[model samples]
Target: MTSDKTELNDAELSRYSRQILLSDVDYDGQLTLTQSHAVIFGLGGLGSPAALYLASAGVGKLTLVDFDQVDDSNLQRQVIHREANIGQDKVASAKTNLQALNHHIEISTVATKLTEAELADLVAMADVVLDCTDNFESRFALNRQCRRHGVPLVSGAAIRWEGQLTTYDFRQAETPCYQCLYKEEQGQELTCSQNGVLAPVVGMVGSMQAIEAIKVLLTLPTLMGKLMIMDAHTMQFRTLNLPKDPDCKTCRD
Candidate 1:
């Protein structure tokens, strides 16, 4: 396997040789993963596992954005950090772990919440964006950024063993944007913090979210324009096809 700079060492090549075995992601795709950049907003439960996998997969460049810090409560779901990192910044802790996973890649950390200023620029630079935030405000911000930049976003959410997955890139004709399904019509969403969430449930969803994100970045088939629902309680998976909304303020393009 070719390396970004130095050739992949025996262990390095053997470690990822399985992923490299796939035809779509052969040496070329591995190179693409190593040379590509992705931004993961919100380093909470979902972001934790997703970011870890992306980093371990040798995704050349990774930008982790989160404004929070590690807390005892986060340990149940946020496996990226341990109890020793309780007081440390989430981005800092995650960066350490990610780099340890693969030092060959570059890790970027933004210890701030998603803001309007310069959000579009980051989205434009990322090959794919992962939205793992818990609140509607951050989620909406990411949605608008994806729409504005025409970057594909694989969003995942898990609360209490139930999760929903969706992919959207209005750049494609007749594809639905996030707001098409959720908008000012709803009063608000029931967040996991307010309700509750299962530990492994977030990992299950977050891992799948990473899979979709990698696919989007590698230009492979993804779950675009479809919503996947996982009933962890019953271990059942269902797909809800999304239809384009002609009047969707964000996806009408």
Candidate 2:
């Protein structure tokens, strides 16, 4: 039977039939995803998998923002960039790969470091924002913008054997934001270049980030106020409640 809300052509129906079979994502939910736009910051380890899955799942538009080039070391975990893409802009490489995955999707690339104003403008244009950057400054800036624009943000981090994923539904008055759990100056940055991350660990976290983004786009229940932590050594996963900080300067308003 065809859906009254979404008119899916034969191609679209065949492409997404498996997901549509699930009770959580029927025809209407699939249409919601196909009509949504997501802006992803940082096209590295976390953003790589997130962007791939979101595009594969048929998100209509994707904006890839990153200023770095694909390095030899990135191939260890950044699956979206192949060896041939070394020295190319990460956003460019990711755009090429994502478009290949889903030809019907629209992909935009921002190959420069985004200033606060530029980032805010992009975040405001998106239905959902994914924080895949590897630094506190970018995360803080994105969090502020998401709060300001009331856009949902799916945040993920992977370092060494530890990884974490969380979602902030800013549209919900009581949801905790990224700043509520992390302080900007609490510590020096620990990038994969320094601390080193397990390859699959980032994939796991990034894949989950995509899941949260899809749920937010479809208006389904997501990890809005919870954090999922993973320890790859023991393969243990833990969920912790994230409470909104009443004194958080970013979201306390």
Candidate 3:
């Protein structure tokens, strides 16, 4: 399963039997998933569920990136980190949990912040990049790198019962990127630590990210030019079209 060949073993077939049952993710789609590589940035609320679902769904390789350590506070929303792993680096804890969930997949961890060049290199090698990072700076950096590398990015953010999910398929000439929707000049960024977020809110967004990542790998329809916003407080969901900004600094060429 690690080589260029894409074949599912009997065990793999059985393990992903439920997913393979779907016409959307049939045998071919499952094999595509097994041959795909997904890079996840941030191991907190969003990254936690995204990584878990991706691993359980049998994405062949996962690169988990996070520079922070797990805090006791993170356990409230970051389900991948156990109480015992509170002091451990987030990438290390996430890898431990992900491997325990599915040992057949390859899980790599980067426990430090990456420079621009380094991030670009990683993005270039990924089939899809999951932007679960908490801040605007990281999100902006990831968006630029993904756009430069022409990799699909599944971006999710949740703070204070509100969450948003979107995908940018940089391979598409007209796809809207993160920078198209947000400007770095908008300096006041809200965080769960500063505000507050329901555990399930981020979980939902992260799970959707996993779904989008798998869809991107399988060449299925995705939310490439749409943003899905969820108001957990009101239990409402709205989707809006995201047009590419010709003036966007990152994607405007």
CA-lDDT, candidates in order: 0.84, 0.89, 0.92
Which TM-score value belongs to model 3?
Answer: 0.97
- Badly placed stretches (over 4 Å) of model 1 are 1-12
Residue by residue across 19-65, what tens digits does model 1's lDDT show?
99999888767767887788999888999999999988888788888
Flag clash pairs in model 3.
none
- Whole-model lDDT, model 3: 0.92
Task: State the displacement of the C-alpha of residue 245, model 3, in Å, after optimal TM-score superposition.
Answer: 1.2
**Ranked candidates (TM-score, high to low):** 3, 2, 1
Error of 1 at 88 (Å): 1.1
Whose TM-score is greatest here? 3
Worst 10 residues of 1 by lDDT: 1-10
Off by over 4 Å in 2: 1-6
Candidate 2: tens digits of C-alpha lDDT, residues 35-93? 78999999999999999999999888898999999999999999999999999999999
Instruction: Arrange candidates by lDDT, descending.
Output: 3, 2, 1
Top-scoring candidate (lDDT): 3
Instruction: Compute the lDDT of residue 250 as modeled in candidate 3.
Output: 82
As for model 2, its CA RMSD to the true structure in angstroms is 2.8
TM-score of each: 0.93, 0.96, 0.97
